[model samples]
Target chain A: MPDTAPPAPSGLAGPPVNLRNPVLAGVLAFLIPGLGHWYQGRRFKAVLYAVCILGCFFGGLSIGHGQVVYFHWQNPENRTYAYLCQFWTGLPALPALWQAKYRDPAVFEDNRLDRELNAVLTATLRGVEGELRGSIQIPPGNPGFGRGFSAPFEGQLRTPSGSVPVKGQLSALMLDPQVGAGSRRRIRGYFDGAPTSDNSGPLVGPIEGSVPRPLWDWYGAPLADTDGSPNSQLNQAHRALGSRFELGVVYTMIAGLLNVLAIFDALYGPAYGDEEVGPLGPTPGPNPTPGSPPSPGTAPATSTPVSPGGSA
Target chain B: MFPATLLFPLLAAPVWAWAGPTRTWYAIPLIISISLVYSASRHEGPPLILRRALRLMLTIGGFMLALLLLLLLLSRGT
Candidate 1:
């Protein structure tokens, strides 16, 4: 050990490194795993830390179809506690915070059309409305809930009693999409078809249908309806992944948490009293490995108590 | 630029198609990561970190397997 230990902010790594700035390394690591180590000239540690942390983070994202990391702190039903851990992954998870603040995801599953029906003047159809034995065809266009074709329709309307041939005109108007609680837009139209009477319209009651919500409204947004809101994206996320949603959350969370250790490693040298391997390595004492044998004196410098701050 | 979700609306669906029953296997990467990071915290050199990480990985994997076996034995035929 040199009888003198010169100190500067950048020379914090003792067993002595020239420019291993610890504070900057910590901040960089917090922003992106391994960045601090990279800044500290620990290239190998940097690569491994980045690989491990980012792999887990992105892997969880892929598992959940990129729906896992979202921040909703104020919403009682959507308070994302896992985000406390997920936040440590740094930049990748930061977007969730932006989304929570700026994006609304203002759409929900309502009378959205499962499929588009083309305009038809008189089309044959079978199994009309499940119980109806005959087919029904209405006008061509995307119909919302409670709305059907304004044009004439021809099909057998099946009843519990028996199959009955029915002919009528379907008329309905689109309802204004007033989102529930001002949070989500529900698109729907109501229509009651005229049955039997060509001039009068449907014999049956009204039906409601809707156009599907845009995908952008739900992706990466918090979806769980834990707040008793029926219009959450959680339903869709749950439908797609089933139980894997939680697993994805766990994976990303662990990755975030793991980066914390890397941050600490960057701020302070090895947690155990292991000497940093470098040209100015001090004599092995103070903290010795339990099983490893001490090295013979190829060379040894005078000893001084090591501080994490590299203070002598 | 438009978000990818808007471009590929259907991407909401899970694309990996991992087997539903075998999610337990997904822990391998997590365990390895945990081992590597934890070991790195305790050692300064890359060689020391790698060697320590390998032992930690084995230890964690063994513990999980033993726990799984215990649960399997306890829950048999239930």
Candidate 2:
């Protein structure tokens, strides 16, 4: 594309356009879609980029319940590559980085009352599986929360063959599967709900239940599975969003990518540089062999350029 | 329905709130934004950008529908 075009047709210069600072304009456009264009007295591109890019970015977040964009560089297990594209959205997607940094695994809620029967017991549980019935008895006021809760539980631990009645004092504490400023926690630790069940000794297993997930922990967070496996995290996220996950990811990535074009436009006029291409695009050159360059008669962007003060 | 939400989340109230309808409906806004932005990048005149963007949008929508139909036909008996 030629840098300069023929002089603009008379009476074309409407307002002053200042694209003198290419580096600054590029950087500013990168920081916020259309900002550099606005600074350069290009309101049309400014509003266009701001509306399209910001709309796409936030729209994606809402679709995925704000889980589509995050930053997780450490622990190669669950590194979030989507963040690279999302970073181009600027401030709207920046909080995830800060939230990820200060995330404390030790912080957890102590309310697991969903599974406790009227049997008056401590430590409620979520995600009650089949045949695992009966009340769990623990110390008053959610026992061993952050440091891991352990207590004896009495219930029928479901086995492959049948329900085995086993009751014993559980040693390891089991918290909910949700952490980070929540009322419950992730399902960790083991509990012997029963002992000597189907002719075996002590029924030991992970606490079972669906703990209510927290907003912060789920929003734009690279949450891993309880076993510290990265493989299932993405699956879990996809399950949560249903088929909308891919759409949300694409929307956000496209938003960032569109801003890249806006940034270039700000750094150096419009991409076509004052060409006279019609809706069908530049005049067609001779139909040449597949990879041949365009003939000079129908060059793409060699038309008259709008002066610095010309309206775009 | 995500389809309704996709079109107008604040309105439309969803005829099937429980069952999110077709995901393909997202192509409407996606194509619109993409075409407009791409066209704006290539032209200084708003009228020119809108004209090019409309053409591009129609072309993309038609191409996508053709692809979808082809895929359905190819997998008809499967």
Candidate 3:
């Protein structure tokens, strides 16, 4: 009797808001990173969708991490790892394609926003691949965790036949993100009196800032030589300098972990039409061109039909 | 240009390999930088920041390689 039929359901009711068919939404998401939500009138998810895919890639460049070095090697294991890393690390370039498919109907058919998004996504993917192949051979010491100047640097050079004891100071420029910006320090050796220096050219000895701590500083005693060559020690040092091999393994693992987080962000994060919850959609801004159709080109506003609960 | 960039490294590779890893390690980064610049610059529609970055990396890497090469050559000549 009290007109309980919802006042005739004004405005266009979207295909019955099927909250049950997650597969439909998932497929939609798979197709165009943010469409399933956009289809459901969720806007913010769309933005997050674009950024995570694009941002990680840009971030990869800043740290010099995404180098691609797969060369179809003969070793099956090596080839398999190469393929794994490529797919594992290079999978962020698919969402925009998803968005391109379910572009907001209100926006102009040739959506400019979609075009820009595509450009950035493509650039980031290629950039990451280029970065992965390019390796930055750091001298020694762990960078980022703490100052690297303190790490032990020890290796024996190799000769044509045997090896010789080689000694050289391993030093790194402490990328201090504090006072004395761009400062560098050097650790001469791990013995009793290891000479140290900081930014201001050369100091007397043993830099005052953060005492150098040696992690694995060791020297192998000279062994018998057969063909005897000075270059041998250096070669042996090169071979022994596989300390960073573990570091590489660690880095690869970290990259893989980040890839997982990125994937999750791509899936359930805020998308278009996210802000329009609560009593009414975002304090109705001065509706720029109220009567005019919402930008026929821009993806539907990221915030549309407020969240289902009272708090939109 | 890339072929030239790569040629020098390839030419010097055996020499560096025979010489030692310190030299080779330095040389590899240089070669990589050169290849990256050559490759990144070739990508169409990149922003200025990206273009400059590629060139900057190339310059740093090339300079390092050249310096190392020069040092090696000098060491060899000496």
Q: Say which docking band candidate 1 falls in.
A: acceptable
Evaluation by DockQ, superior candidate among 1 and 3: 1
What are the candidates' individual DockQ scores?
0.34, 0.32, 0.01
**lDDT of every model, 2 decimals:** 0.59, 0.59, 0.30
Q: Residue-wise lDDT of candidate 1 within A30-124, one digit each (tens)?
A: 99999988877778888999999999998998887778888767667568899999999888888677656775443223323233333222222
Model 1: residues >4 Å from true position, as ranges?
A1-14, A17-19, A104-219, A224-231, A273-312, B1-21
Ranking by DockQ: 1, 2, 3
Name the lDDT value of residue A183 in candidate 1: 25
> How well is each residue in A110-164 modelled by candidate 2, as lDDT tens digits?
3443343223123323343344444544454445445554555566656466666
Q: What is the lDDT of residue A31 in candidate 3?
A: 47
Query: For model 2, what is the error of residue A90's alpha carbon versus the real structure, in angstroms, after optimal superposition?
Result: 1.3
True contacts kept of each: 0.68, 0.60, 0.00
lDDT of 1 at B39: 75
Compose the digit string of candidate 3's lDDT tens values, residues A1-312: 131212111112111122223445445554444454455444443443334333433333222222221122333433324224323334342222222233343222111111111000000111111100011122322344333433232333233544333222333324221111011111121211111222222111222222211211101011112234544322333244444423333333333333433233233221111122223322322223223333111212322433333222
lDDT of 3: 0.30
